[model samples]
Target: MNQLSPNRPRASDQMWLDAALDLLVEAGVDAVKVMPLAKQLGLTRTGFYHHFRDREALLDAMIARWEDKNTGNLIDRCDAYAETICEAMFNLQDCWVDWDLFDAPLDNAIRHWARTDADLKQRLDQADNRRKTAIVAMFQRFGYEADDAEIRAMTILYTQAGYIAMEIAEAPADRIARVPAYVRLFTGQDPSRNEVERFRARHGF
Candidate 1:
């Protein structure tokens, strides 16, 4: 299990990682080489060596950053306090709208990268399973039965995965307008006006 860190990495380390991530997202992992990143950042290869031992080490760090920011924030949202299942769903949905909570582009990039790397593909599968487990637990905490919770968790997760895979785009207002209906469909219960308002407020909708 990878331990999640609350502390940010040093500024110089993050700078290299950021450049590598952009290259990864824009041109796939093949383009995220040390030479490319060094050129992109206008930094010498020596600077990269100061933070990472080699290209492979930098790649490992990239995966760690993705897992920490994306998966870590998701689990945190799943465990966020909520008085009802509707509210809880909203809390988790925060990941959909909040880039800080979920870096969907990075998630997409990593998923694509994993397609060619067996070890990374395994880690990606594990991450998905972990995310579903958290969602299932969240549902169970609100009185869902074991079987119902499992299916509900899968539905929510797979739906979002579909959105990401398809690169679906929608205006913020349009998506927010659909949230109440979506929450109802996912939870079998409509969110209260207060719960909906709170969800909107959090997203500045």
Candidate 2:
């Protein structure tokens, strides 16, 4: 008699969420429906039901995942210890370079989805505010005035966001070459040679 393997990988809520995110990036939110995700995962709809009550429940989980992992993690990284303002800026750069942590594609997908969903738009706005507030806090830690910190934080955040939105493709070497300039422009001081070299080494440039 044929028997199912006892060790077969069972589908989890995170697996469904990951599949939904992949579909969101590949085909947009419209294609993230339960049937499509189930087909993509090679599982039946019953697997999805075990994790999510409905499509709306799955969407809510996805949004929460985005907010917690992407937004909250970035803020935490910015708050990491650094010896100087320049070092702090470099620390934040780690968030930008590490795609797995920041997930630009998913961020962009959510922004696009927010266009059609008012509630999501409001949530995005709140996330944006929290991110900016965290950045400002980072600057203030370096003794920058509140007004200065706010302006500089906005400049840094918006510039990175714009780069991701424009989808500009550049070689690793090219981007590495420009990091010092970007850090200087954002922080009003150039990163030390050690800081730059450490960054390059981190990205294998």
TM-score of each: 0.93, 0.93
Off by over 4 Å in 2: 1-9
Top candidate by lDDT: 1
- lDDT by residue for model 1 (125-165), tens: 99999899999999999999999999999999889989899
For model 1, give the 10-residue run with minimal summed lDDT.
Answer: 2-11
- Cα error, residue 174 of model 2, in Å, equals 2.4
Note the clash tally of each candidate.
Answer: 0, 0
> Model 2: C-alpha RMSD to truth?
2.1
- Candidate 1 structure lDDT: 0.89
lDDT of 2 by residue, 34-138 (tens): 988777777788778888999999999999989988898889888989888888888788777777678888898999999999999999999999999998999
- Model 2: how far residue 30 lies from native, Å: 1.3
